[model samples]
Target: MEDSYRHKGMRRQLVKVVRSKGIKDERVLDAIGKIPRHFFFENALVEHAYQDKAFPIGAGQTISQPYTVAFQTELLNVKPGDKVLEIGTGSGYQSIVLLELGAEVYTIEYQKELYERTRFALPEMGYKANFFFGDGSLGLPRFAPYDKIIVTAGAPTVPDALIDQLKVNGCLVIPVGNAKTQQMLRLTRLEGNKLRKEVFHDFKFVPLLGDDGWKK
Candidate 1:
């Protein structure tokens, strides 16, 4: 009964928040409503799961706010059955959203603590993303040519490794900036060795750590 009420409130907030934020994609909106956010957090957050604010999930990382998550997912332009690669699987919320939208998810998490917690939390939520414990800045080369790649972390610049992993006409939505802040960027592989890029939004996230990102 409590879970039902919580999910109901979350669904209501999801619609109100996404629409007000100008995320006009119907599919994205539906996916946001369908996924249950409380499942990703500990019992304490089941009530506040509907709020449009980032929440602490330990290890100095956070589960992104609803507006941010909705905005970013809409930017991905996801379609059913698409294969998605997600960098920085904090709390596994982004991965869950992508999966709910009918994408085959392959996610990477750099923090061991967060990764394990997410690994346990995700299965219970009815998702089956291939989760990896590694450096997210180094795109998962083994699964090259993803249909869509979404990086939740912010880098100083676009990672060439990630670019190389994109399929023809595939897209990668990432953030690029310095230690203090970052700007969201979208890179799309056109064709025949040509690529196109665009800036999506101005947002902040923890620095993406690895060879292809900020040193810190």
Candidate 2:
């Protein structure tokens, strides 16, 4: 788990790439710049870590493109100490980003292998979040009412459970569409449980699998 100066330099360049792609939130950009993404990859594939592209992280999941991660994090509008729920922990990269933003994160992963791997890996990298192994599409109901929620996989539709878990004025950022591609959506929970929905960029993500998502 070595993050050499060369890796830090690559991260700086990666930040420039994401910033150029219209990620104006300096906090988001800073997180993108600070995280050692190479630590999430195997030594052989570390070179691909800062390329602004999504790469395989086993279990049929991806680490997501850097711009996409920044995009969603920007939409989340995290405040320091906000309680954030993250679906599809994947390689735990996004969780770290949320952590860097000063959010208390509760992240869940559906794939057992990824769940186990990230549960151990993140803390070892000096990043920690409350990790759970379960169907993320169902959200985490026991800890309902999060200040923000982010889903890393593509869903057929926005899961009701996630919306229900958001606090009033809270935000949930997810990509909703078919298995191949999804439209990035931001839903802000409003008074009376209503929502203000806004849609943004199209992205391709691995299918979200669970009771409320695509069937296994």
Compared with the true structure, the alpha-carbon lDDT of candidate 2 equals 0.93
Candidate 1 stretches with Cα past 4 Å from truth are none
Considering only N, C-alpha and C atoms within 3 Å, which residue pairs clash in candidate 1? none
- lDDT of each candidate versus the true structure: 0.84, 0.93
TM-score of each: 0.94, 0.98
How does residue 108 of candidate 2 score in lDDT? Answer: 94
Candidate 1, 213: how far from true, in Å?
Answer: 1.7
lDDT of 2 at 4: 88
| Candidate 1 lDDT, 161-205, residue by residue in tens | 998999999999998887777788888899786888787668888
Candidate 2 clashes between residue pairs 3 or more apart in a chain or in different chains: none
Question: TM-score of model 2 relative to the true fold?
Answer: 0.98
